[model samples]
Target: MKIDREKLHSPFVEQVERVSGEVFANCYQCGNCTGGCPVSFAMDYGPSQIIRLLQLGQEQLVATANSMWLCVGCLQCYSRCPKGVSAASILEALRQMTLRKGEDHEDVGGLPFPFLKDAPQQAIISGFRKFVS
Candidate 1:
């Protein structure tokens, strides 16, 4: 997508910063976060790409991606970030932003009871903490 010069001042960046508690403009697209992400294989856009999207103020992709839901809160991205971007926190912030719109990022409503039952308690509880109202 073409960069909009006017949108460089958009509210999207501030919202992300507010929720993520990081100065997102510091990100330099070094790809370190993506390289270190444990779950990057599961992400449509890995941590570095998400940070790049946020840095570019690409609100549409940043807010709507399934990548945020794919984050397992492993903090590998945060640890490897030389610029302290905390990409996982930005992902979590995006998830919270989606929830603030009264929409869920994860749709596990159709999962069989036994399937959920076999999952670890931490997984179930964390899912609730992240997904439930």
Candidate 2:
């Protein structure tokens, strides 16, 4: 597989820092964030690994991972971080970046009618905001 040097040359780390308002350098890989995350078991990469990837300017790896999309925004990571870095916010920034690039994580029209009917209104609305472009 060919790596995109252009993306590597881009200010990916700075952009993530700017968009998320969190410093990647502050993370010490303590694993507290991942340990505290309620949904870490379901993620392709834990919060610490994601932050490390960001620190190393591995945006493509971070972008391709399902970890960001799987983040539940529960703030457990932030609460557990000694530096108070918010991985949830970083994931949100990643999602926003993907959305701004015109990519939708979920197909709204493809949602099953039965599931839509059975799901709570709050869940449906939240899904739309999170998954739709």
Candidate 3:
């Protein structure tokens, strides 16, 4: 499918840029992000592809991609990037964007609570209370 680079001027694109900045612009698709990604095997499109799709304003496809939600936030891609691009953190910000849009995810087969599940219940409850406050 053809991607319209012009559509990248949309508000959603701006949101991505505001958070990620020129890191997205520096990506050369070297596949280092994908190679360093621990969960790339489970991702429909690797980290570099996601950045490309975002640059092309493929918002719908990006929002629906399961890879965004599957990222383990290991920072491997971020640390290994030759361009010093924080692809892992960028995926996180993108995931937040996806969730903020109230998009529905069909690929709900991964972990139940990505962040909270890793922490103790007391810590989780404390966080819940903080949110409720």
Q: In TM-score terms, which candidate is top?
A: 2
| Candidate 3 off by > 4 Å | 102-133
Best-to-worst ranking by lDDT: 2, 1, 3
Model 1: worst 10 consecutive residues (lDDT sum): 2-11
The CA lDDT of each predicted structure is: 0.82, 0.87, 0.73
For model 3, what is the error of residue 42's alpha carbon versus the real structure, in angstroms, after optimal superposition? 0.3
Query: What lDDT is reached at residue 5 by model 3?
Result: 55
What is the per-residue lDDT of model 1 for residues 1-133, given as tens digits with 9 covering 90 to 100? 9688655657877888898898877889899998988888888898889877777778888776778888989899889888877988888888888788878645678768997989998988888778855
lDDT for model 2 comes to: 0.87
> Where is model 2 more than 4 Å wrong at Cα?
1-9
Off by over 4 Å in 1: none
Each model's TM-score, in the order given? 0.87, 0.90, 0.72
lDDT at position 80, candidate 1: 88
TM-score of 1: 0.87
Model 3 lowest lDDT segment of ten:
124-133
